[model samples]
Target: MNLSSKSVLVTGGAGFIGSSLVRELLREDAEVTVLDNFSAGDPSHLAGLDGSLEVVEGDIRDSSLTSLLERKEVDCVFNLAAEPYIPYCYDRPAQFFEVNANGTLNLLLACKEAGVERILHYSSSEVYGSAKHVPMDEEHPTLPLSTYAVSKLAADRLCFTMYHEQEVPVIILRQFNCYGPRETYPYIIPELISQLSKGPDLQLGNIKARRDFTYVEDAVRGAIELMKCDRAVGEVVNLGSGIDYSVEELSHIIGELMGYDRVNIEIAKERLRPLDVERLQCDYSKARELCGYRPKTSIAEGIERTIDWFRENNERWIWEVKIAPSERIWRKDDGC
Candidate 1:
């Protein structure tokens, strides 16, 4: 599965981690085609790449993804498409299942149909509800606490069974908390950053919750390396920072770096999830042994980079604050 000059199809390739993977693919001179519905991904995020980068605007559930895969002469597929926002997944569980679970089936069938050489299917670390043990590894029990996590875990198993029964070469990476430019989800880091950037008070819920945050670049790097590793097929591996940071701790760090010492932290009742997973910390040693994965950026460095991105590109994520608050708190609820 040598990626150099190989034809590759990356579904949801315009997304935060996906876009970063797209850049890596282009740098490696792989013929790349990006498929995204723009439901949670912004096309504008992929503003610059050209000459070996092809963009397809479509959904994974539709026949369009299969059709594109058939026509693209692709050697490998990277399945990164999902309805991943936690709060939104709770709001629309059916839609989340439709996209994350069923959509994965569509892509797996397409890959099998196309006889693709390799497929890297990404699952969320949220699939592991909380740390039953510190430094949770590949063998951790999956006790998904949210609809979004359930959908991803479903898809994760789907990929595995399809590999065994259907003989599709699928690799699953249960990615931990990933953050960077163009991250669509309103996770505590991004949401809190948005709130603190625009105003003095940072309104958040479940501040005690903790997670292992991985920078987007490191996550993408690991994914690409896994694509080239033969042992990665039919394997479920975790990709994370291996260190947990509480939301409370992150608020002060982000505030300090952004030079807002006076930023007030207030609990926003509406922002809390129905059943929150309390904590997550990754043990990516299997990934290290298999694909030489070593997450280089520390949390401090990653937060600095993320804050810099938000400061530079306020307009893109500012919509998050406006739309989210208005929908949940400020706007009057009137059934249509």
Candidate 2:
């Protein structure tokens, strides 16, 4: 689907990656309607969008999605809405399953009813779990270790099933560790940035595990590229950097990017996942072959850019972290 002058519906457009994709779609002058419940997303993310962008406050689990799609007459629907935080999923598996699994079923059914073509579903590398081999590809055995991972795996397979069984025009684009500005949950990058934002010491867990990180902008670009590739319909592709870096190594690089002096690193047992995936590296050869997907932002450059954003918006993250730190159980903080 050519995005230029087309109408697109981006669910969860107020999120970090969703907002980035909204900007990308707006650059092409596509009419966009963003559907979000603002649970973790903020209206501020979509503040500067021109008349081409429409913001709707709603839940992906709601049947109103069908009405919205019918009204907008969108050519494509991008499902980026889900309950994705790992810890949160552990605490409330029912909630995560409802939003990540059943909520997806709701949206896919709506898309089918509305005759919306080319639905791009957001997937994650967590579905691949610990890599049995280096640079895990789409064929990697899915041994999901966490509730969040299991929920996403269910949703990812649901997309494939919809495509094959119901003939729903759908594609699953799974991305590696995604990080950038407006990132609510403190992953390694934001945890370091937020800690530095307030003070000096960085508290983390399981720094030995390795991950393939991808910047938000490049992930959005890969998603859009996949959306346009006609051959990608009913297929799954991995958008990864094809490189893995340890959390400890990433922390030092982040410190370097932030230009920290005598950085204090502390390991917090509470911050670690109950069962951690040892390593994940992306084999995006299929992405390159199918959709010409190449993540442009390197970890160094992306960290620099993300640090710049944190520096500008220090108060927002700092205040939020102070209210509900990552060590404590996840809370529904509406401040941001």
Candidate 3:
């Protein structure tokens, strides 16, 4: 679907990746309507987007979403609405199933009803679980390690089912760990940046585990590219750097970039994943070949950019400010 001059509906556009995509769409002069429940998303993330977009405060599961699609004359739907936190999903399994699975069902039905020509579904790499082989590809076996993973896998399959059975023009993009500015959650990079700003000493879990982290901009570009590719319908592609990094290494890099003298790292048992996937490396050959997609940011460059953003918005990291006085003092002295 040519996005130019088309009205696009981005569900959860106030969230991290969705907001990035929203900004991109607006840059192309495409009319955009953002539907968000504000459950895990913040309106502050949409601070710079003034009148260029319409904001619909609602849930994707609600039938109101269908009405919004119809009333707004939406040509395409980008479904980025889902509970992404793994531990949160484990604690609230019902919410996870409802939002991730049932919510997707609702959106697909709405797209069908609204006669939406195209749909892009944002899925996660967690659905692949621990890589049975290096550089996990789309054909890799999906043995979800967490409840959140299971929910995402179900949603992903639902997209494929809709394309095949219901004749919905849907494309699924399984993104790996995406990090950048305006990311609110205590994700790895944001969490480390927040902690490092408090002090050099940081406590974390499973430092040995590695993940394929994609810069948010690169992931957004991949999504846009996939949306433009007509052949991408009924296909699944992985969006990632195709490189993995350990948490310990990430901490040291972030600390150094933020000008910290020394980073004291300790393992926090309570913070560990119950069934941790030790490693993740994506095989992005399909994305490269199909959508002409390539990650432009390296881990070091991405971390540096993220650190700068966090430093500029230190007020948002208030929870990380509650550490020991000595740690706080250290952070203050180090210009964090």
Candidate 4:
């Protein structure tokens, strides 16, 4: 579908990645409508973006999404809204199923009813769990360990099921860890920047765990590129840097960039997830072949950019948010 002049609905458009996608789509001249509950997404992320855009405060689980699609004459839908915090899923497992699984079902049904031409559903790399092999591909065995991963896997499979059984024009875009400015959660990147900015001493957990971190802008570019590729429909494609880095390695690099003098690091039990995936590396060969997807940002450059953003935007929550690494069971706190 040619995105230019097309009507697009981006659920969770106020989110980190979603907002970035909105910006790119607007540059493509697509009329965009954003649906979000504002639970984790902040309206300020969408600020200063010029486009034919509308923001709606709503949930993906709502049945009324069909009417909204029809009313807006939306040509395509991008589903990014979900309960994405891994630790939060531990306490509210059912909420993950409700939002990530059933909520996706709602959106698919609405697309069918509204005759939306295509829908791109965002799936997480966590669904793949630890890599049984290096550079996990789309066919990687399903071995989700956490409640969050399980819920995402459920929704991931749901998108495939709808595509095959109901003929829903859907595509599953499974992206790996994305980090950049305007991030809502205190993910490793933000947390590291947050902690490193304060002092040289660092407290972290699962430092040996490895992940493929894709910069937010690169991820957004890949999503838009896939949306324009008709062949990507009914397919699941991976978007990532195709390079993995351990948390410990990441910390040292950030420390060097921050110019820390003999940095001190310690393992903090509170920061550990009970069933954390030890490693994840993406195999985006399918995406590369189908849509010419290539992640342009290197980890060092991405981190540098992120650090610069935080440096300039110190008033952001990440700078002031209290990180209780010493507390037992350090709950995911925004420190708002």
Best by lDDT: 4
**Every candidate's lDDT:** 0.83, 0.83, 0.85, 0.87
Give each model a TM-score: 0.92, 0.93, 0.93, 0.94
Candidate 1 CA-lDDT value: 0.83
Most TM-score-accurate candidate: 4
Candidate 4: worst-modelled 10 consecutive residues by lDDT: 325-334
lDDT for model 2, please.
Answer: 0.83
lDDT of candidate 3 at residue 192, scale 0 to 100: 88
For candidate 3, the TM-score is 0.93
How displaced is residue 101 in candidate 3, in Å? 0.4
Better of 2 and 4 by lDDT: 4
TM-score rank, highest first?
4, 3, 2, 1
| Error at 330, model 2, angstroms | 12
- Give the lowest summed-lDDT range of ten residues in model 3: 325-334
- Across 103-193, the per-residue lDDT of candidate 2 in tens digits comes to 9999999999999978999988999999999889999999999999999999998998999999999999888888887776566777777
RMSD of 2: 3.3
Residues 1-336, model 1: lDDT tens digits = 679889999989877889989998898899999889776566777887865988988888887666687798889999999876787776678888998999999999988888789999999899999889989998999999999999999999899899999999999989998887766436667776767666668778998999899999999999999999999999998998898989889888888877876668788799787899899999999999999999999888988888777666644332232454223222211111
The reply for model 1, stretches above 4 Å from the true place, is 318-336
User: Candidate 1 vs candidate 4: which has greater TM-score?
Assistant: 4
